[model samples]
Target: MGRNRKWIQICILLAVVILGGWTIASSVLDKTEIPKVGSKAPEFTLTGLDGKTHQLSDYKGKTVVVNFWATYCPPCREEMPDIQKQAAKWADKDVVVLGVNVAESKVTAKNFVDQLGVTFPILLDSKDKIRREYGVLNYPTTVFVKPDGKIAVIKEGLMDEAYLDRTIASVAAAGNGNK
Candidate 1:
């Protein structure tokens, strides 16, 4: 009877340990949701491909598209051309498109940009500080900031050219109206 009781106690203790561990693990592994529209976009300063520093607040009077991406992400690669095209179209306007590469080396990002023929500014987040500040849980996440420095839109995953164009136009229009 004593041996049986000891075994039962051990089993209960093991079950509690397992259950507690699972609970903690699940919470830690859960991905956080990216910020939503109408929120103040997190400010950051990162080095662009031209070796110049770009700050989110620097484009205060203009609309900005801040895209978080990486070289290894398929979705990020898919949206590169679209972002490049949009940047070209809005080059003369009061608009800036910043492609922030998260946790990747300068050489890797440069190679990817050259291969893809992308002309837009690709900023480097070497320490992933901006990623954590923005709660970027997925690659190819884009946040559209209005001229007022508030987030106007948040797009996750891959976005096509048409969608980006429309979003840019809308944001530009809004900025113009607010001016």
Candidate 2:
């Protein structure tokens, strides 16, 4: 009975070490540093749902909102309508909302956007390279870039219309007094 108890304790110890090691490794690997505010927005050229190529550099003089999302994320679904509203509200104001679908099929993204009536340009990050470039570790991350092409805000998780408007206003007021 003593020998069996000793073996059980050894097994428990092994399990703890393995679990601890995995936790440490996962945290280290999963952490991709998000871009600092005020840093130059990383340049990316992605194909929109419209099949037209959209480049971040092309929208240089506009307030750009880049939102990274996946179809399976519940928070992403909840925030879609608000983002659509903001997109329309700021459409004439030179503020462009770019919906970047991370690692989701075009069909899935298209259907999801269509259901939400999202009019903003939907860009496909098929390879998830752009997500990595932005260091987005969470779904529904929104990076607001100024007209001068610098990141003004990095919001993780759900972003509401009020926050969207506020960030846009904040970015517009920053760097050379851009609208």
Candidate 3:
């Protein structure tokens, strides 16, 4: 009985050690160093669902909402409609919303966009190069870029329409003042 109890204790200790190590590794992998606010936004060129190349410099004189998302992320899906609504609100303004789909096929991204009925442009990052450039470790990360091509804000997870609108407004205000 004593030998059996000792064996069980050893097994439990080994299991705990293994589980703890996995948890630490998982956290480390998910950890990302997001760009600081007011820093110049990283430049990247990706192909859009429309088959046209899109470079960050294309919208140099506009405030852009660059969002990194995936089809499987629930929070990303949840914020799609809000983002669409905000896009329409800022349509006449110098604001553009670019949805960057990370590591997904054109077909999958097209299906998702069709299902959502979104009018905004969805760019495909099949190689995850753009995502890596932006340092996105989360499913739904957003970066607000100013007219000068600098990052104004980096929001992780789902963002509300009100907050998005406020960020756009702030960027627009700053852009106008710079003129």
Per-candidate TM-score against the hidden true structure: 0.79, 0.79, 0.79
The 10 consecutive residues of candidate 3 with the worst lDDT sum are 29-38
Give candidate 2 misplaced runs (Cα > 4 Å).
1-34, 175-179
Comparing 2 and 3 on TM-score, the stronger one: 3
Model 3 earns a TM-score of 0.79
| Model 3 clashing-pair count | 0
Worst 10 residues of 1 by lDDT: 28-37
Residues 1-179, candidate 1: write the lDDT tens digits: 99999999999999999999999988975645455688788788889999999998988989999999999999899889989999999989988999999988899999999999988888999999888888888988999999999899888899999999999899889978988
- Please state the error at residue 9 of candidate 2 in Å: 68
Tens-digit lDDT track for model 3 on 1-179?
99999999999999999999899998986675456788789888888999999999999999999999999999999999999999999988989999999998889899998899888889999999878878889989999998998888889999989988888899889987887
Steric collisions counted per model: 0, 0, 0
